[model samples]
Target chain A: MTGPRETLVGITDVVKHFAGGGNVLKREKRKVHAVNGVTLAIRQGESFCLVGESGCGKSTLARTVIGLNAPTAGTITYRGQRIDDLTPKAMAPYRRRMQMVFQNPYASLNPRMTVQTILEEPIRFHFPRLSRAEVKAKVEEVMLSVGNDPHWGSRYPHEFSGGQRQRISIARALMVDPEFVVADEPISALDVSIQAQVLNVMMDARDQRDLTYLFITHDLSVVEHFGSRVGVMYLGTVCELAETKALFANPRHPYTQILLAAIPRLDASGFRHTRLAGEVPTAMDLPSGCVFHPRCPHANARCKAEIPALKDQPDGTAIACHGIEEGRI
Target chain B: MALLDVSNLNVEFPTRHGTLHALRDVSFTLDKGERLGIVGESGAGKSLAAFAIINLLSKPGRISGGTITFEGQDLTAMDTDALRSIRGNRISMIFQDPMMTLNPVLTIGTQMVETLQAHRRISHAEAKRIAIAKLREVTIPSPEERFDSYPHELSGGMRQRVVIAIALLTDPSIIIADEPTTALDVTIQAEIMALMLDLCETHDVGLILITHDLGVVSEVTQRVNVMYAGRVIETGSTRDIIDAPKHPYTRGLIAALPQQNEAAQRLNQIPGSMPSLDGIPPGCAFNPRCPHVGERCRREIPALRALGEQQVACHSAEEVAALAGNGGSAS
Candidate 1:
């Protein structure tokens, strides 16, 4: 195992933008700024979470980091080396070190392929030099590591339950022995009972493999429970970053506070649904100054004109809200 | 009067191997203007219970036994032809997938108008006008513009709001919303819950909300029913279910959820898989996974015993609650 001090992934000022069009021939470009200027780091064995609403660029950032979609600007360096500029030939090695587990296990795996074939395909591609017997042994070990019975490999993805397919997906990710894994909403598409089982299995595997995770999800409860530190994003910007305790206990940002209040909580009497205003704003046409200013209950005139950059606080956390910065609330 | 009374309702789907009992001896009473939250894990038959009330279960799935009385009308015995008139005009429903309740090619206006026309003999123009007003009643953003948009054109939240608007078109006496906001984000979910709660109060409609979310049920429902493996394992006021859950399954679910408190070392996830439909254990369905299982629990399926306003079906309910630190005597 590598030293715990190793920097598994370093993402610096990563930006991703997609251009759609009204006029195909006239070349009208309507750019949707998905992940604009995101930067964070993941140590060798820490769990990091990127949390936001459905359209707030969490998934885009995950894809950008895993090299699925190339970023529009900035650098993605794994273990202190840049690979965005490299050709496909040079990028092949990086692919083996980083694998992604998608949200929908039903669609993520090949519908026709057996779980055994899915696991073996990665092992075959990443370790072409290994003999057939060695590849089969490695695949079985990977399956066992993910808490799936080795015999389950013969079953198709449909034959297994949602939780089991997720295990298969995780097994496929581990078959390559990736140092950094991007788990994108892995538990969202599961039953609550099944969700618990899958989460436990993932945690156990993370421990044994010493894997670095870029855990992307919309569920703040899971994020607080599992993430070592978290970055709360809104409108393609990191609004807040802090240790799990500091963030949940004394959230510095107004958006972060709103999100926390919005989640349903159970007390003796019943569920307390925090009454926040309106729906999430369309990212294409966000507010002029602060992305969260329109929704922030503590917004002022100053928030409407000047954008707040992430500023340090006495507590070891970073927040980018004018209200937090000026102590307005 | 209790606006809705369900007694010994059992739903079954005829599979090749055997008849799968999706619901078993389910019983509950919902008074007028009351919100009854049904909470359970997936496949716990929470949604199936809701569907059964509407007589909307698919082919091969039929009501095996019992009755549902709405304002003294035998809902279980009413044929589909007789049911259709009262179904939308009096009792409406919303689904977890908002799209399932909506037609894709039809504009929001066309759909609402058709629903209005089916029950009330109104002119086409009058129907359109009422549809617009109903749309506004549900607080859809720019209802006029949204009335023209198809289901596909609107966002998930908007579609759900429109679905609620359709449900409220006739001022239904009862509304069964099956996980309405389970698809939406937190902010939007809160908005939807508040909207539904307000509408239910204004109309004095009995609302039977089917959901697995403890938080969702607790926020709006006056009463809560905890289901497990196709049985209503526990029933009480929301306070009792949340603060003084008696059944081990209820306690297990509460413990499993991640609380907001930052001091948690780990979530207490309930172990063992939910027994498959065909593999339900004979005694307590939750016996294998329940932390407080005893000898009697594995031998006999306990009947729901009366305890104040709450009802629980567990042989060791008292002992389990005490051990689980409920800090109160089981009634």
Candidate 2:
């Protein structure tokens, strides 16, 4: 599973920080470290999932990879090409190869636009010379592939159900024939039953289109089923990265172990959870050393003083924890 | 007698076009200190069923026909003043979004004290003392400091804990939580749920947990009601229902879970979405999406019949049970 593969996207020590309240007169300044020194490579044809709680900067990382948000430091390479610093006009070609699917279908799709118009806008923008009939054919093809009725393409987005609206969103993403997609919590807004339908559509699209996915979500169950490789993030840093099966079966980091243990499994009878001491700290005011040390039961004096770099273990998992490296936990 | 007993409950929203039956024939019972979970998709009337029990339905929505009996007293027939005494004092409710449920303008202590004083004739200082204890009971760090904070000062998970504390302030016998943890993160949800379970057990409180997560239902509740299209399609022990679900809809829901299947496999999705309240199909409301639909299922409504320890509202319950035994596949 860890065999050599073509790296589609390489993120090297990427950092995205947003400046907080500070006036010209006031010398005091604050910065929200949304993504802090994260490094990872997304292999081609793999479903790479970034799992974290809210405000952990998983969304910010996804946006940074797609060039939606510029990194404050480090570099982002796309297929052996440095594309992060490219201007909008220079990055236009990469844009066609990469796309994004947002979480909320209710807000992602324009209520005023018909599904036909929504799907065709991307095709028309990418291929302006195509005939109207050709563009319509592409729209219908994508819609049918997503298990939506092409005839319903004329209907407004508000007319469709949540599941159908998500299908439309997927169809729009596929309109440009993108090879890679960054789906930010795509199915979180849908119901459990509807989540399966949308996930099936996404898997089908991946297989049919040979598309690599940067899947970001907080749901561990979905990640176990959908992700090929998983990255566990905490406070804007990649705490652990490993194959999905390895990560689920033998989580390395303390936070990863706690996160996996906290999931309510159907096979389990009673409620049992890993008891962490404190809540997730605010991103604006990060802790001194290991960001997760405050709540980590395995944290020691060393863990509280110095941040551990993500080190590769014998099992091929990169874990950022001194306790794991020292065999303390 | 059970702490809470709802029978033949029907909730409707009368519109200009027609009366939308949001909940029909929804019935369940909660024993003392027992937790009952209502699992369903959105628009399935799980929340409406819980709302109707407390007579907290918004305008245009009314309990057209039903009996919600609590401790041998009919809640639906009670007068406003009488119901008011029972609403917060005897049966407290928790909504999904704690931020919306809590009063943003008021401090935590003020709100909890208000709730305590509204139900019991206690002095302000006594109410404040009780409120502080409840806050501490929910495990909010530094209860004294947090009591002065408003809703915006707390995080999503802490706000939910505050909401739970408020619900438990009156020492209510029954707590109807409608997706209480849905708005929080998964880890936070686990902690909050564990806290609720521990508190409920310690205090011998009956809980009516309404959620869409089957995993949470299987872990928390002793008994479960699986709802579909405004109807209680299946009701049984959580163990029995999760292990060998009798209804096609229930089986579909369990199979639809991503954990039930292998990685990258097509999930066993129930074909179509649930019907809107007004457009629910005749006969069996789930006949359209049900895998085991028959001619009788299409022509007549099935009554909830007892099969072993489970109550199933399916014309093909026996066949479905047999099918489940032979490896139930939702595809």
lDDT of 2 at B220: 92
Error of 2 at A287 (Å): 0.4
Q: What is the TM-score of each candidate against the true structure?
A: 0.92, 0.98
Model 1, C-alpha of A94: deviation from truth (Å): 2.2
lDDT of 1 by residue, A237-269 (tens): 999988887898898788888788777777522
A143-196: candidate 2 lDDT, tens digit per residue: 899999889977998888899999899999999999899999999999988999
Model 2: residues >4 Å from true position, as ranges?
Answer: A1-3, A21-28, B328-331
- How much DockQ does model 2 earn? 0.81
Tell me how candidate 2 scores on lDDT.
0.91
Q: Is the docking of candidate 1 incorrect, acceptable, medium or high quality?
A: acceptable
| Candidate 2 chain B, run of 10 with poorest lDDT | B322-331
Give the best candidate by lDDT. Answer: 2
Poorest stretch of ten by lDDT in candidate 2 chain A: A20-29
Model 1 residue runs over 4 Å out of place are A1-7, A21-27, A131-137, A268-278, A300-302, B260-264, B294-299, B307-309, B326-331
What TM-score between 0 and 1 does chain B of candidate 1 receive? 0.95
